[model samples]
Target: MTVRLRPHHLLCLLTYIGKGYSPAFIAGLTEIARRVNAGEEVVIVTGPDDICAPLLEDPDAHCHNPGVQIRDANAARDVGALLDRDIRHGLRMVLTPVLVAQMRAAFANQDTRSACARCDWAALCSDIAADGFVGAILQAQDSTAE
Candidate 1:
């Protein structure tokens, strides 16, 4: 099965470390991370996606926020440029080790962080990148090209 994701989530998965708004949210994201690391196909979507699923029922959910949409737009732009592919809805891919490694390199350099502006988790993600992604839950299952 495929994992449905929003563009910004492409960044979030890079720094996931078993934390989130709630236990259920963490659990849901953890499962998604597992699937993604296992080489599942990923399909980009427009709005609230698998990462937002556990919080969708909340009255204050940020899934549909304008800022969130902006983040998505920024992510699409950044990741699309990095991959040289349009990172839009229905764009399909597998996050191979080489690709993930390249993304991580860009992330570590803050090259793809326009999508993280105003995000509550931005600092944590930045720290994860700076720390060489230690303790991150979603590790590539193979050696990176480096």
Candidate 2:
């Protein structure tokens, strides 16, 4: 099954290191990270993707926040440009090793980080990238000839 992800989550998957707002959130992200690492395809969605599932119970979930919508838009723009694809709802992709390397380089250089503006975890992600992604959980492999 494809993992449903919001646009910004494409970036989030780059630097996730098992920390979150709560234990449930961390568990959900960890599970998704594992599945993604294990080779699940990722399908883009407009809002409230699998990463937001654990936080959905809150009436004031940040997933529903308007700022998050802007973040998604920015992430789509940056990632789309980097990938040379129209990153819209229903787009399917895999985080292949080469692709991941390119993305990580861009992320480390802040080339695709417009979406990280105002994010609570932005600093942590920056630090992770600065440190060569130490402790990051996701692992990517080339699934096809490129």
Candidate 3:
């Protein structure tokens, strides 16, 4: 099955190495990640707030806590649009090496501090990027490229 790929999803896949999010959300995201690693054709979904708001509203969801402020809706939309454009016109796939490289470049080009201000994993993500932990993210490769 094709999964809807979003910028937040890509960021989570890159930086989330351990416990976070509700179990149900984690399970669902894990399945999506698996499909992505298997070279599945992902449909870019730029509306993260729409897709995630309900999930985050669940009391069991990790993001439901008061301390975790939701990301700015406009910024999320902008980032998602950028990623969608890059995936469709630039990379053609959501989880390919080329896509990853392009994403890293995009991150480099922007002041991610503001973009990631609401993310709980932002500090950890910055460390991962500083440490050049691309391998940690790329290890999701589970299928031969189609």
Candidate 4:
């Protein structure tokens, strides 16, 4: 389904991004909410997050809450396969804690350092050079790319 953005969603989105939320998470939640309101069967597959329970309480929803298993999944095998599927079919649903964290941190800090250097998207986001509103700006770029 096509997502129609109103002036307010966009405005609130901008504000949220400025606060360090990840654009992907924002898009994912918006998409899910749209589907839920449209009366579609929305199945949310996500890692654990503080807000997941409340969000899933809405009707017409199902949730798969898996904790972060990024490392356990073995990036090359599991992640690559998931990416391959996503590339061809797009995401089946939206609701992942890792995505949430990414969005939250994206809005909170624009610092270049990744707390540690192992952040996967660091280079793509110039996270190593992030500061001030840099993270939010990068997320905007990410949203367009998506």
Q: Which 10 successive residues of model 2 have the least lDDT summed?
A: 137-146
What is the TM-score of candidate 2?
Answer: 0.94
* Alpha-carbon TM-score of each model against the true structure: 0.95, 0.94, 0.58, 0.20
User: How close to the true structure is residue 5 of candidate 2, measured as C-alpha lDDT?
Assistant: 97
Per-residue lDDT of 51-120 in model 1, one digit per residue for the tens? 9999999999999999999999999999999889999999999998678878888899988999999899
Q: By TM-score, highest first, what's the ranking?
A: 1, 2, 3, 4
lDDT of 4 by residue, 11-85 (tens): 122223322234545566554444434544222223322223333454633223121233212322322243343
What lDDT score is found at residue 54 in candidate 4?
Answer: 39
- lDDT (Cα, tens digit) per residue for candidate 2, span 1-146: 98999999999989999999899999999999888877789999998999999999999899989999999999999999999999999999988767887888889999999999999999999999999887888874434456
For candidate 4, what is the TM-score?
A: 0.20
Ranking of predictions according to lDDT: 1, 2, 3, 4
Which window of 10 residues has the lowest lDDT sum in candidate 1? 137-146
Q: Given candidate 2, what's the lDDT at residue 99?
A: 81
Q: After TM-score superposition, what is the CA distance of residue 128 in candidate 4 from its true location, in Å?
A: 7.5
